[model samples]
Target chain A: MEEVHGRHSSGWFDVCQHRRMSNTRSLPLLAPESDAAAGPCCPPLTERPFTAEEAETAARMFKALGDPVRLRLFSAVASHEGGEACVCDISDVGVSQPTVSHHLKKLKEAGLLTSERRGTWVYYRVEPSVLSAMGKLLTVAPAVL
Target chain B: MEEVHGRHSSGWFDVCQHRRMSNTRSLPLLAPESDAAAGPCCPPLTERPFTAEEAETAARMFKALGDPVRLRLFSAVASHEGGEACVCDISDVGVSQPTVSHHLKKLKEAGLLTSERRGTWVYYRVEPSVLSAMGKLLTVAPAVL
Candidate 1:
């Protein structure tokens, strides 16, 4: 039951959530251009209700971080010595290599993490812009205007 | 297929994700005690890697917001007048009342929103402490400490 549940949850995370935000070009953010280019960006959600497109895009990233394993993997990478980690370095997450890779792919696709091949392993780093944006979007902050 | 995808995703959101954070007392945050009591709380995720328990609790709330429709509903209710709204007011989400209620229950159960019954309908309001804690938890802000 746990295995089936894991498979289905990860599948949904990949298909429904990840696919929805596949086109970073179309993601609805406060500063789409800068955000896409990895610049500082994040419009406050308190300003107004999110449009249909924005909600879908933001929800995908949140969904990507929705699993405990993925959250731990992400945190392990984000909090690594240099703000990134190679597959070998994050091996302590207790999951198999394939599962780790799968979560990495989902995180990258959701824009929360970016990965690049380095030697024989893939290194992953948190996409600060996207992570910041997601946090800011969900923030129901005090009215400071 | 879309329906199946939606059902599966929402089901996973409800099952594994929701159930993990069902206990508010165990939620990870700067001030778990205060936050659980509806007081000010939430440290910062960037401060440290969340413990296994913290990761599980936090992921549940994030997963609840993974759906577009739920996001829309949450945003509408959050942005509604007085920082609260009834089922009738959030009708703009386009789903039926039951769907909205279900999502609201998920949000409420995750500690993001609180509710009270008044007259013919239930009124929902953002739990500032919980919402703030979630935002602070996810925020990878500049190290001010």
Candidate 2:
């Protein structure tokens, strides 16, 4: 789980690649039927049942946000100046420096946030594609709800 | 945590009330300077940092979604016919009956889903407001990314 810039970091990259391929392949398989059926056949929780793989993949991201500290940290970074913040900006979360970094590392591995080293400190920003994908998975249209 | 019809069933209700009250109370507190400042001041996580209470409340929903089995079960219900599914419909998830039920109960208690008894079967449906709130929390505008 402590995969900062390690194999865990590349796991989401693989998921990203798989998702891209799934999108490209599923689009052409849709038949000209009802609008829902006519659209691409990609699997999302709200649109269709989750495959086992999809469940595990999406669960990782949700697990990363499950902790209060991590959720707060993510919010701090997301609403920070220019949508990015360094460790110093988030020091107000009241956790230790190493704890904050540890949580940040989890967010990165789960593909919710990305970090970049800048001289003496590392800055973090929300990963919009991952967030958007998760949001869309859980989002049912208001009318349908 | 087994609060299907217990007092714990009302926990998320309290959280929801706190969130609504927070939203109403925070807006007027914002200084009339910048547009962001003038808008709602509640900690939706995207617009502003989360207070400790908001983090605790929102984290409960995400924690309920952290497990892979629970995540899949939720998807099964969300994607099922009429946006509702019974235990029988989700039995294909490769988990034992009790395990699936346990996860389903957690989802229900977290306010992500609602359950109703129909004869011998219990049906579950996603709670759109809670899902929408969580989705909006993580959803950043495309331009921001």
Say which candidate scores most in DockQ.
Answer: 2
Per-candidate Cα lDDT values, in order, are 0.64, 0.65
User: What's model 1's TM-score?
Assistant: 0.71
- lDDT, model 2, position A62: 81
DockQ of 1: 0.29
Which pairs of residues clash in candidate 1, taking residues 3 or more apart in a chain or in different chains? B30-B43
Candidate 1 CAPRI assessment class: acceptable
Residues B64-110, candidate 2: write the lDDT tens digits. Answer: 98898998888877766566766765755777768888899898888
lDDT of 1 by residue, A2-83 (tens): 4533323333332332222222222122333433524433355555677887777777877888898888788776666456
Residue-level error in angstroms, candidate 1, position B118: 0.8
Two-chain DockQ for model 2: 0.35
Structure candidate 2, residue pairs in collision: none
TM-score of chain A of each: 0.67, 0.66
Specify the poorest-scoring 10-residue window by lDDT in model 2 chain A.
A21-30
Off by over 4 Å in 1: A1-42, B1-43, B141-145
